[model samples]
Target: MSAAARAVVDTAALRHNLLSVREAAPGSRVMAVIKANAYGHGLVEVARALADADAFAVARLDEAVALRDAGLAHRIVLLEGVLRSEELSRAAALRLEPVIHCPEQVSALEQASLDNPLRAWLKIDTGMHRLGFPPGEAVGVARRLMASGALAKPPVCMTHLACADEPEETVTRSQLAAFAGAVADLPGDRSAANSAAILAYPESHMDWVRPGIMLYGVSPFEGRCGADLGLRPVMSLSSPLIAVKDVPAGGRVGYGGTWTADRATRIGIAAIGYGDGYPRCLGSTDTPVLLGGRKAQLVGRVSMDMIAIDLTDAGDAAVGDEVTLWGADLPVEILASRAGTIGYELLCGVTQRVAVSYV
Candidate 1:
């Protein structure tokens, strides 16, 4: 272990989560979402770990190139598709499958003359206003792509779920219905479910299921955790307590003297803070960190390189003791709630300053 903060990744847990995804959507092919540096868990490392996945999905072309550059031969799908003619040609050379969401991407495909045709996914905007063509234009767009002759086969039909995590909401059902109606006559396979839909809406798991947060063992739904869904957390953020000292009553801690000791007690300084992507908002809150397997409340303002944890409840605490910010024992979802954010943001917010070690 290094003196600074470190994020330990459990490869076994990642593999387990992939298996869980397979169990949840048994009939659907798994398109593992490894975009955004695999949610800040190391891109290539995760791709290597889940090599058995049917395919991988990324937001940009560079991520796919990175995977290919790593010597990985797995099928890579570009979620955003290509923007220019050169990109379309390059994607074809890489044997990438780009999601044709808009007419611009389709035009790029139509104008390009590649040595080998590309396999693509056609995205329809059922409700999510972010990407994809309008639902009414689905058939016309499909016809255009088929006429372009740039595709090796008919494009897979897909859509993004806006609110699959909210089970009580009717939006997901409406979106699913819209997707089915739009692609009912279209050729090729279909995909609609993200991590939440994979767990909650079984009907949405048509031909392919794109699993993102669940692959990292983080829950997409509120009021639940990964363990509750039978998923194991893969990342454990920890740091060693650099200093241990006692503060007298009326003494202040950290910057701006925000926290005052009501009585004399011990405080331990951990070498992790916002600089390492540990939420600074956690400071001066009731959020707890595990110190030697015991809970220790955070106190005062979080500094750039350090945070002070009240060790009054932590028995036999000392310098060099391990302080876990979040992991299998303390779910990141709880800490994210305390920090006024979600687990996805917290996980992806982990900066490059901290070293990552895979088990």
Candidate 2:
């Protein structure tokens, strides 16, 4: 209880989610995606929790190196791969599997005289233009990389899904087709499914499945929640109600007087706000919080260090009552929708100002 605001991470729930991923993609090797500081759940903490995963995936070389430095021997793949000579050298030295997306990365690898050869993934731009070579050019790029002798083994073929979360399977099907066509003659294992693809599109689950947000017990689809997907929430953000006061009818609350009481109401000021990564955009009265185990709506603007929730219905609410902003009972996905964002942003946005305790 270092801070009034604390994010309790359930390690058991995290392991359970990983097991769920295994059940969904039993045939494919699980490349647990723990990038972006494990989506703000502490990178090292998440890696240690998912140690049973076949391998781990990060977006940068430093993240991979950090795991190695921590003394864990799990295979790590750098999703974005290396860009410069130094990064290439460091990645190779760390035995990191870099996903070579662009020709510049391949050029760097070919030119660098590393201490050891590196195994890598060749990313093809099936539909997502963010990274990788186009389908027309991927095979040639793979062939050239193999001939360079910088790689320890043949590169694994991989691609990103642009619309795996959408119910319309047209885009995912097309991307899968393009990926298959691009690497049809190539000699290597293939990976394509992300979190959404793992649950929705079974055919996309190839040799490897990189489960990201799903591992954190958050659903990628819009209408569904983590529970709907049989995933248990890992992070439960809670704060204490520092103050409880009575506001008469027409009394305004919070910054800008945004919310006015329609009748005499009880208000509870929670010790959490945008400063602690609770989105300031969550300003609607429909947004609810768990106050003393009862539903309470958020009213007025969210401040940097506090938020006012309408505790009128919870007459028994008192000062120092535990407030659940989002957790097992209160879904972050719903909270995200009220804030005009997604669950990923909410989970990742939790700032360093707040203390995180693993349970």
Candidate 3:
């Protein structure tokens, strides 16, 4: 039989999460951030499932193009904007909004055809040093986009929140202040809130609310998890327990003997591992899993194709019993924490070998 390790996409749950996001930011437009292949939930499938979504946000040009080719008529916002001048015409034709963040992008947009001047969002660097014009120069960029005869309409002003997830930080408030000050005179609607802002800071929700992780039912706050927020998990990773063995006390297991049995134990081998997007950094022990509705503990390092779960209580477990590596049974955040990472990395890093099964 084919390997049983799989990442299951929950379509109904995805729709439910989108509704929750809308509920969180009532009346405001919602741009579902489906980047990173919809947080590894399967982009096309999530896109299809959330067809009623107000708009979709992606990072690269190809992702936007793919949506267009898929006959998705909703607005697709390119977060990185146009990387090259050639993208302008295509973006215009596809009706994708490019989030112009730099002078090179502006020059490319100016050089592109005017007939289908693309809709654009101007990103201002409030505090996040990653991208966008400095706060002082944002107003000028907005004006330039409007003045360009090639442009069809005024640009929307936007800024990314540097620390919206951390409510205690003054950064989010500072960012909001900067955004408000810079776009004071700019003529189009503005957006600044990410998932955290949409949830924790209502004042940040302006013309548009961009929710990425929250749409996937993940908690934006660090040290917290989706379950803590009443959000349902949309991805459940599972595999079968294919082997069972009895190990004596003091027996060593897995690579480099990272884990050792302290007493008589039953080890159930689950066909999931780092190669399947499970965290390699998760210690040989202390990692958690669910087997047949019971908690199981990892007793060895995650291998390329399997994880050994301590199943002393699972005397009934057999070859085909389902083992949950994450989701449903254990929150992805919990797994990510034990793995020393975040849900984004764990989701997006699922390797190719594991067959993805959508539920």
Best by lDDT: 1
lDDT against true structure, model 3: 0.83
Give the higher-lDDT candidate: 1 or 2: 1
Model 1 bad stretches (over 4 Å):
none
In angstroms, the error of model 2 at 234 is 0.8
Clashing residue pairs for model 3: none
What is candidate 3's lDDT per residue for 76-146, written digit by digit as tens? Answer: 99999876656777788889998989998887766676457677889999999998999899878877777
What TM-score does candidate 2 reach? 0.98
- For every candidate, C-alpha RMSD to the true structure in Å: 0.9, 1.1, 1.4
lDDT of candidate 1 over 55-105, digit per residue (tens): 999999999999999999999999999888889889999999999998888
**Candidate achieving higher TM-score, 1 or 2:** 1
Choose 2 or 3, whichever is better by TM-score.
2
Candidate 2 weakest ten by summed lDDT: 1-10
Each model's C-alpha lDDT? 0.93, 0.91, 0.83
Q: Name the candidate that leads on TM-score.
A: 1
Ranking by lDDT: 1, 2, 3
